[model samples]
Target: MTRTLSIAIKENIYRELRKLVGVGKISAFANRAIEKGLGELEKEQKREKEQLRQQLIEGYQKRTKNKELQKTLQVYGEIPNERNEYSLSMVGLPLTTDDLKKFLPVEVYIENTPTTGLDKPSKILCDSPFTWNKGIRFKKRLGVVSKEIIEKVKRT
Candidate 1:
């Protein structure tokens, strides 16, 4: 057996319901709304996450660039003479022998000779890491080398 009941709704609410139903079935309309809302929320969340990631990367780059620039600047000031070769003591910049080789010329040797002092000599030395010596030749030469270029080269 089946039974039917009639119910009354406010005029405005009834009009709105009728309009919605006219566009599509109630179930279909509700489902579409739910799907669209969820999709929009997801897209918004993804965009936020991407933005946060970009911000973090940019912050890290800025910080590292600043540190590299500072190191390069300190070394730039201490350009060594022929007698006083550039040493790690000039600046606290952390660089490997390979890095120096890649950035500088092949003639530059990492001098391991101990200097007479209480301060232990550094493992790596350069005839002129910042400036090229007369004997040294570079495969590629930059017109003007700066701390920024050094940092960028190292990053690559």
Candidate 2:
């Protein structure tokens, strides 16, 4: 049985297909390609379904019994979930040469201690000989800065 069907395809792909397979045989080539693609899709779906079924069976086999559940509950009532917060509470301390030596090559936020006449705190990369004074307090920066920002800071 033969049925006429019209479909839209990309010009480049259509041109290639027409060049490879003549207009008279285009329908046959497309039919074979679609059947092969559908077969592969069906196989993939079956594989996924079997994988999910195996996981379900394994889950059922490993499920804890009522007694084991009760024992776990007794040992730890309403267990708290794991916390993943990465924030640190760092207190600012007066900047000293000793601290600069202690935490060498660390990124720090240096704040002017009112007497330095500086406008705002600056993020600094403490690789070598840092300019320090009695009127400066420093804290380690919690987050990372971009390479561009680092370069800009270095330029100044």
Candidate 3:
């Protein structure tokens, strides 16, 4: 099931997104972006919550070790987090956008046959991943070393 939603973006960003995804796939591209962002936020929230719980536990134990605060805190329902206790019941979430752009491949696939008067070559910022890091020249140098190692092992 899908619902219609409208959003406004800057003209330049919209143009860039269209070039990256397609003319009419803005909605799908936005959805994929949001989903990926949400996954990262969830993991970060989990990590922060665990860190906070540990801090609270440490604070409570330090207070209790004094002997006087221990009896006082015990009188009230509030206690240390040592018994696997947490104050936060609801999940709330909230990194690196720069590193992603550095390594990830940005590509566009052409499948349909070219139509007359509609196709033009566009200047792209980076070489296509399929061409950039492929073929004999780009293949691992480790292959030669591995072959030498294998030959040596066979002799032994």
Candidate 4:
């Protein structure tokens, strides 16, 4: 047995119900609409949560990577002080001039201080100067590259 109840609804809602009543029972139509709406809402909420989770994961990964890069640069003496030039002794594993060329798109400017000797250029320069625009544009690509490189290094 089925039970029926008469309930008052807003004018606009009643108008909408009237349209659907021609094709199906008002209760059935309303119940179907409510179920469909809930399903769509559930899907939207799940998508939003997943997006937030991914964003958080990416943010943490980026922060960790930046810290590691800073440490690596420090260990290799690649970090220049007030003086823009890097000492040859400081350029160590993973932080070589070649690595900078391969990884960074910006022009690598090593200001070599003059030494007491023949007037030959002190510093060696690469073929192409690094540019931030190039590197910045390729950030997403470089991020994938860096993650792979870090994982490989970690394993070794």
TM, every model: 0.33, 0.39, 0.42, 0.35
For every model shown, the clashing-pair count is 0, 0, 0, 7
- Give the per-residue lDDT digits (tens) of candidate 3, residues 92-138: 10001223334323322211114211133211122321111011112
- Per-residue lDDT tens digits for candidate 1, residues 1-156, read 433435665889767976868744645565677789999999999899767656755554565534443232211212323443322122212223344334344222223223211122122223334432211112221123345434443443
Among these predictions, the greatest TM-score belongs to 3
Off by over 4 Å in 4: 1-8, 66-156
Note the Cα lDDT for every prediction shown: 0.40, 0.45, 0.40, 0.39
lDDT of 2 by residue, 1-156 (tens): 878889999999988999999888888999999899999999999899767656754454456354332221111001111221211111222223233334434545444435333344443443433221111111222333445544543543
**Residue 154, model 4, lDDT:** 32
- Candidate 2 overall Cα lDDT vs. reference? 0.45
Better-scoring candidate (lDDT), 3 or 4: 3
Best by lDDT: 2
